[model samples]
Target: MSRYEVDKALWDVYRDASAAKQYRRDPVGFLAPRDLSDEEREALAARDVRRLVALGSHPFLTYNFALRLAGGFSMPFVQDYVGQLQGLVVGDITT
Candidate 1:
C-alpha cells in the first residue's frame, strides 16, 4: 500500500471547508485516528510542508493544506517548501 494514505486524508480534509476548519482547530486530534506513520503524523503535527513534499506528497494538496492551516497563503512559506522539494529532486537525480 502507498504510504500516501495520510496525504490523501489530508487532501480530503482540505477539500471540505468544514472538515478543514475542524482540522485547523485540532490537527492532532484530527489525525489521531488515522493510520499514519510516525513521520507522517509528526509532519502534520509540525506543519512541516517541506518534509511532506520531500516525502512525496502532492505539491498542490500540500499547498492547499498549508493555506488552510495558516488561514491564508504566504509566498515566503511556499517558496521555502518548493525550494526544499527542488533540493530533494536534485539530490535524487545526482545520486
Candidate 2:
C-alpha cells in the first residue's frame, strides 16, 4: 500500500527466508542482529517506497534508499523495478 509497507513486507519475507543453518554456524553473530517488528518494518518500507516514487526521473534512487534502509542494494532487482517505472514515465512524457 505504502512504501514503508512494501519495505517491511519485503524485509519480513527476507527474515523469514533466512536459513537457520547460517545461524547455527555463527549463533552469536546472527542473533546479535537487530530485530524488526512487523509494524516497524511496515513503516520503514512505506517511507522508502514513498521516497522512490517521489523521485520521478530518478526512480532508481529507491534502490539506494532501500539499501540504506536494510543495509545493501541488490542491483538486478532494483534495476528491474526502476527500469520498468522509467519506461512508463518515458512513455507518458512522449505522448
Best of the candidates, lDDT: 1
Q: List the residue pairs that clash in candidate 2.
A: 3-45, 3-46, 4-45, 4-46, 4-47, 5-46
Candidate 2 per-residue lDDT over residues 1-95, each given as its tens digit: 23343333334334543533343344334433435444434333344344334332133334444444444557775675565456343212110
Best by TM-score: 1
Model 2: how far is 84 from its true place, Å?
A: 5.5
Score residue 78 of candidate 2 by CA lDDT: 64
The lDDT of each candidate is: 0.71, 0.40
Residue 15 CA error for candidate 2 (Å)?
23
Question: Clash totals for all models, in order?
Answer: 0, 6
Write down the TM-score for model 1: 0.72
* Residue-by-residue lDDT tens digits, candidate 1, 1-95: 23467677668777888878777788888888888888888887777877776676777777788777666667886676566567565122111
Residue 18, model 1: lDDT of 83
